[model samples]
Target: MSEVQELTKTKEKPLWYVVFTYHNAEKRVEEHINSLAKTEKYDGLIIKAEVPVQKRTVSRRGKIKEIEEKIFPGYVFVKAVMTPEVMAAIRRINGVAHFVGGGNEPVPITPEEVKRARIQDDLSEEFKAGDTVMITDGPFENFIGKIIKIEGRKINIALSLFDREMGIDFSPEQIMKIQ
Candidate 1:
């Protein structure tokens, strides 16, 4: 690519923000933000919204199904150097509960943190679906589960909490990432 092309692409990145969205609102929030991006309300302000997604597996009567699951429930990441109008539009977006930072002041998601959650495509595996594991933390402590698949950072676990065999979905931070 030419130097000018590289420069244009580099300008696309901005300070990132960790946003707290309404329950089950990650997709809608992202869509709204992206749509607003084309309007003049956010002129010259560039924002990249991301709702990290993962894959999930479900079993029904001896059959398995795959589903797309969000990595951070009720949360979405936005990369943009916020201007006054940009911030205003963000709050107006549907399914946006609030920003994690204190007050209305804008905060950016660190480049390092974003990089930490980066996808590892080469080392990926269709994890041995159905391997039992124990939850190390979160609200569900000491809980054991059966792994259905390993999709990015999320895991679809078949957990029996009091004989109710329900499927619990979790991210890397919510459980022990290691075996």
Candidate 2:
């Protein structure tokens, strides 16, 4: 391997970063930042630094589909402490133009927010459209529905009124979700 490529492989991975403002520099910045990670091993502290990425598809006519990569671009996240040395090393890296939300001091990104961001970044699976649902949202405040039909926000439910089995049409707000 080339000397440069070999050097690249020795870099440490940092986790949990609050990278800010790479808005259009995801790819370039990853390479640049990772390279810097090696040139300056701030410490044995870097965890896993990365720019989260995901893909999406667009449907076309004739049932045709095309896949595309979505970039949250211009954001670099590093999973490391904000120690003077580590922060100094990160600042020295390319593509990391600034910290998240913008401020002079180093800001730590919360794990919860980061987890939610990572989880929602991609839609792995969709709701099964479960057997028709029934919910009563009006005067029939105590009513609920099974599987009927949903149009816009209107849901038709098969609810038992009094003691008679029947299908009632009502807004989801009027009904409560029950087993």
Candidate 3:
């Protein structure tokens, strides 16, 4: 309520900034930023760094595996009190290219956009293995296939392509029940 208190509150308020990293370096950048948060230079100024990811099922060589895929590749979200020194330090981190939203001034991410980026696709309860489905998106759109495996939010389907059965993995939203 006091002037000094108000100043302190506004100064400490953290906003989410988007940092662009090199190809396949989102995780590394996030870790580096987090590690720097504990050091004297970044203490309090840097709050947290996060790379949004979702669990996906992948099929390779007849083996079904779950993998965590980045929701937004090459980007990491960082919560921090924006300061010139902090921005410079982030840019200096290895694997981090620069902050998004133009040159020196970086824009903070909107709360809505952050929420959407963090949302995880839920597995459809109505779908199960052996169920016939129709591909709704991607290169196999409208193609009919049979569910081969259900792992987490990924649905492995067997589709006839070029007269041969090919195994493919899709998110639940990409396929619908044939019935």
By lDDT, the best candidate is 3
Comparing candidate 1 with candidate 3, which one achieves the higher lDDT?
3
Q: Cα deviation in Å at residue 102, candidate 3?
A: 2.8
Q: What's the TM-score of each model vs. the native?
A: 0.55, 0.46, 0.61
Candidate 1 backbone clash number: 2
**Top TM-score hit:** 3
Cα lDDT for residue 13, candidate 3: 46
- Which digits, one per residue and each the tens of the lDDT, describe model 1 over residues 1-179? 86444444343324568779878888888887767766676533644577877788999789999988777788878765576767777888877878878787967755467776552322122235666555656888657677776776678888887878888887643443223
Ranking by lDDT: 3, 1, 2
Q: State model 3's lDDT.
A: 0.79
**Tens digit of per-residue lDDT, candidate 2, span 1-179:** 86434433453222356666545766666666556555546434554466766666667785756564544556766655456677776676665677765566666666476665562321111101234332323565534446455554455566677888776666433443322
lDDT of 2: 0.53
In order of TM-score, best first, we have 3, 1, 2
